[model samples]
Target: MSLAWNASTDNVGVTGYGVYRGGTLVTTVTGTSFTDTGLSAGTAYTYTVRARDAAGNQSANSNQITATTSGGGGDTTAPSVPGNLRSTGVSSSSVSLAWNASTDNVGVTGYGVYRGGTLVTTVTGTSFTDTGLSAGTAYTYTVRARDAAGNQSANSNQITATTTTGGGGGGKKVLGYFVQWGVYQRAYHVKNIDTSGSAAKLTHINYAFGNVQNGQCTIGDSNADYDRFYSAAESVDGVADTWDAGALRGNFNQLRKLKQKYPNLKVLFSFGGWTWSGGFGQAAANPAAFAESCYRLVEDPRWADVFDGIDIDWEYPNACGLTCDTSGPASFRNLMSALRARFGSGNLVTAAITADGTSGGKIDAADYGGAAQYLDWYNVMTYDYFGAWAAQGPTAPHSPLTSYTGIPQAGFHSDQAIQKLKSKGVPASKLLLGIGFYGRGWTGVTQSAPGGTATGPAPGTFEQGIEDYKVLKTRCPATGTIAGTAYAHCGNQWWSYDTPSTIGGKMGYSKDQGLGGAFFWELSGDTTNGELITAMRNGLG
Candidate 1:
């Protein structure tokens, strides 16, 4: 019998609900609903519910209700064996599986997903994601259909899959953003990541900046995303793109090849960015419609296998960013719930969130903690705390790991941001420290120390006051270290950024803090030999 009850509130918070059968506890569930099987026909069962918290406090029992099974002899025949069990996707700590359903004399109650012959979990849905698994491990899986009368079908055909090298909450995640426009003036191609040895050390890549417009997820750049042709030399593999009608090309095709070379890496389509976050308000107003549109795009058949999931990069849910949103604090959680419902457990759902740690700031402007239940993890954008945007003076590091004596603002550092989110009930394991693979600078700085006054933003290759680590590592090497980062002043050009040595220090902090992993803003900023990524991999170990 399926049972549900209204949620009970608590001062701290209700962790779960305990369902009592005949005045005795039967089972506990986090959600308000429960399903009980294996009852005799025509029998009435009395049930009551009590709410519970993490500290073991329980609420008084609710009013009792009774439910009776149908008036008939108990079902005896088992369901047919489930057919064609298969693995849909594999990650470092999870496997997505699906199978054909089985019919029974009565009705199919649920499907039992088993791993290595052990019953893992039972779900009413046709698909499930087995999580909390070890990295680089192989596990065989099978499924069995269950009927209401307690009869279980024979095991379905078994399949095996190996997990990726690094993923999940247990392993260190190294995710880097691959900007779609990097192929233009940046002169960085997807193949360069492979040739530079960055791909092997990375666990996941976020294809940045898919647009969110008209309450839908749309392609950001057609040519750079999939239309541009690549020669054999520019391809991750030695194969060149052909003019064949359906031939895949561009970054999408190259990423597919990169995955073939490194089976452990997962890729996600990330929508929204600082400049394109304006459409998020409309998305928040109608989350279900937005999620449906995103689902269709991410699961499109043309390049269905190219992505494993979607990453939302809403700059601020109910606060100000490139544009302001007034959808209220609950909007973020509602949007995430919609996405999770549409994508199901078989696909990863994550988001890139703001790191504004100030009290009553952006962090407190949304229900991020409430939304945590739906996200696989969160990419905490811990950078951009202070930068050339300040323009004239008081130049500070764009990504500070900790507070300092003369800090420009309190709670504007990476540690503060992570702690603030944790205080709001977001698990530390779900947080990824953000790193900038570039430097922010100010020109006309006289003093050698960080507090020196500056005239304006320094000139850069692409944009003023910002330069890639590849250029800064050589052009303006580190001269001092502060707040767990590096800074340099060369010929009136004052710059601050993360070096390999500083990254090692930050990684130690990541381990000490029990963080999930670290992610960088972009890939093109690193050295041609992937010096920064190498440091990140070694440091995580």
Candidate 2:
């Protein structure tokens, strides 16, 4: 078929055209245009089409049309350089790098990541993780955008990031679990942690509270009566009196001493637990008074230097805890806003929340997503899905990684809890995975590992409940793996606890999901050598 030009712009009424390549005429046609076939692959050909009239007069060629045949479409443009590069506050052996999305003319398909002038990875993502680098070493990175046509854009501005010093060998994310004091004293149950090895792996040691009592801070010695109100109720089925100021100062002084010993540790006073959560509704009602009381309690001149931040552990507001508070969800956001304004940005504010992944759980608790904007991180209490309370025919997994064939609760697993929070717009980096140092079990079991049943609640030392993970790891080992978690049965007792192998699996999941890190209930429950903690740290690597 003869090629026809749409229109002729030259001085000649084009009758025919000559197609020339590299100073040689490739074809001549009677029509205004000609098509040249049989072009070699990957070969560059410069062509000019000259129009000739019926008088044999020719016109200068239109702008030269230089085309290159392709073996395949090769990308010539490098990726757009990454922008808004930032470094994390506490660096470890390896550093995380993230940037804004790159742009391309043909639609960006992926990215070529470079570290210190060397290509590290070609990721189809805006972020790339660089591992195996020396701690405290500085790294310079540049990213380029790749289009569908395989062409890449020029490199964007180079951004530099530095790794932190003194991580435990490999590029593991080090998360130090700060045990809330008094929950586990220096006893074998939750106390004996190996301080020597902990220093190298730990990034922060969080001391539970500075104020005593389950909830209230006794103003004076008269408050001694309220010291163990909740624990007393558990023992003596009676309601305890409020704040007897007598023992308040002594407990504060004791906290001061503990802080003196661990200077590098961060002491955070956590207010509100299961029993003491009643006052939060009232406190949350009056944001100004609550903020004032918190400031005075945490910032007391005597222990001002001792505390680094304040953690709000309101068990459940507007929902049921040991008691229920009707202070609507907005109350939580208001309280946190006042606290953030009063405490300013320097102090850290965090909260412990239930892992109930249902709509009721979200409404029962205050505005967690709203509060997230004010707080640094939201710690999801992922454990305690199944416990002695569910004393029944079919046994349940306490801290299941995923939903199994017969999970006790429909979406009560750790994975569900985390995903629920993420779906609410809470960044993964700001969410801390909760790990229980204790295990929940039942007596009169039948099935073997991970899938056994008990007729009643398992007996504990002080309470007829759960035992620490340290004890269960040795006492009862799992026979089978359940959703990357473990459970076992020995004799008439069924136990569930995370082993090093299972922990390793969970850690991989956490990293793949881009989570911040893991935190356990109390430190004292770990082995003297900190074996479980080490497993968590190493697994994070």
Please report the candidate that would top lDDT against the real structure. Answer: 1
TM-score of 1: 0.69
Candidate 1 per-residue C-alpha lDDT over 375-448 given as tens digits, one digit per residue, 9 for 90 to 100: 99999998888888888869788888876646788668887777667666677678888889999999999876
Task: Assess candidate 2 and give its TM-score to the true structure.
Answer: 0.60
Question: What's the true lDDT of residue 484 in model 1?
Answer: 83
**What 10-residue stretch in candidate 1 is worst by lDDT?**
162-171
Kindly report which residue pairs in candidate 1 clash with one another: none
Give the residue spans of candidate 2 off by over 4 A. Answer: 1-196, 209-264, 363-365, 449-452
Q: Count the backbone clashes (under 3 Å) in each candidate.
A: 0, 27
- Write the residue-wise lDDT of candidate 2 on 342-411 in tens digits: 8889898777787887545753366776677988777778888888787853676688876654566667
Which candidate number would show the highest TM-score if scored against the true structure? 1
